[model samples]
Target: MRGDSWTESYLRSDIMRESVIYQAILEEGELSAKLTSIPRLLVLGLTREQIAQALDLEIEQVPQVIEGQN
Candidate 1:
């Protein structure tokens, strides 16, 4: 997905990852990450809650944004 920037790059970007992490952990997970405030999609100072809010979801319903490298 990361290789082909046109096909799946949009779905596997850092911003997208953050959104997924924020939403998945928020609703499905046990809130173990403790994401409080919102996040910056620019990767400057993004938080768990920020990603969730950006994705139009609750802090407790955000997904887990795993680093593509790791």
Candidate 2:
């Protein structure tokens, strides 16, 4: 019964295995390092000051990193 339910859920969505969002969700901690990337960190609504604090970086260094990305 448990195996049947697992198979049912897996087959319910025809595109689950090919879905980027689903794959990303399954990756779990695989993206932990990317979470600290400046652009990704900014997209998650972190301010420069907050990012600097979290990364142990100088507050002034944040803008330079942002500028270089542009």
Following a full C-alpha superposition, what root-mean-square deviation does model 1 have from the true structure? 15.5
Model 1: per-residue lDDT, tens digit, 1-70? 5567665666668678899889987775544333332223525666656677665656564443333223
With a 3 Å backbone cut-off (N, CA, C), the pairs that clash in candidate 2 are none
Question: Per-residue lDDT for 2-62 in model 2, tens only?
Answer: 9999888878665666686777876654444433476778989999989878876678777
Q: Which ten-residue region of model 2 has the weakest summed lDDT?
A: 27-36
Number of backbone collisions per candidate:
21, 0
Instruction: Sum up the clashes in candidate 2.
Output: 0
- Score each candidate by Cα lDDT: 0.55, 0.74
| Model 2 global lDDT (CA atoms, 0 to 1) | 0.74
In Å, residue 43's CA in model 1 sits off its true spot by 1.4
Cα RMSD to native, each candidate? 15.5, 8.8
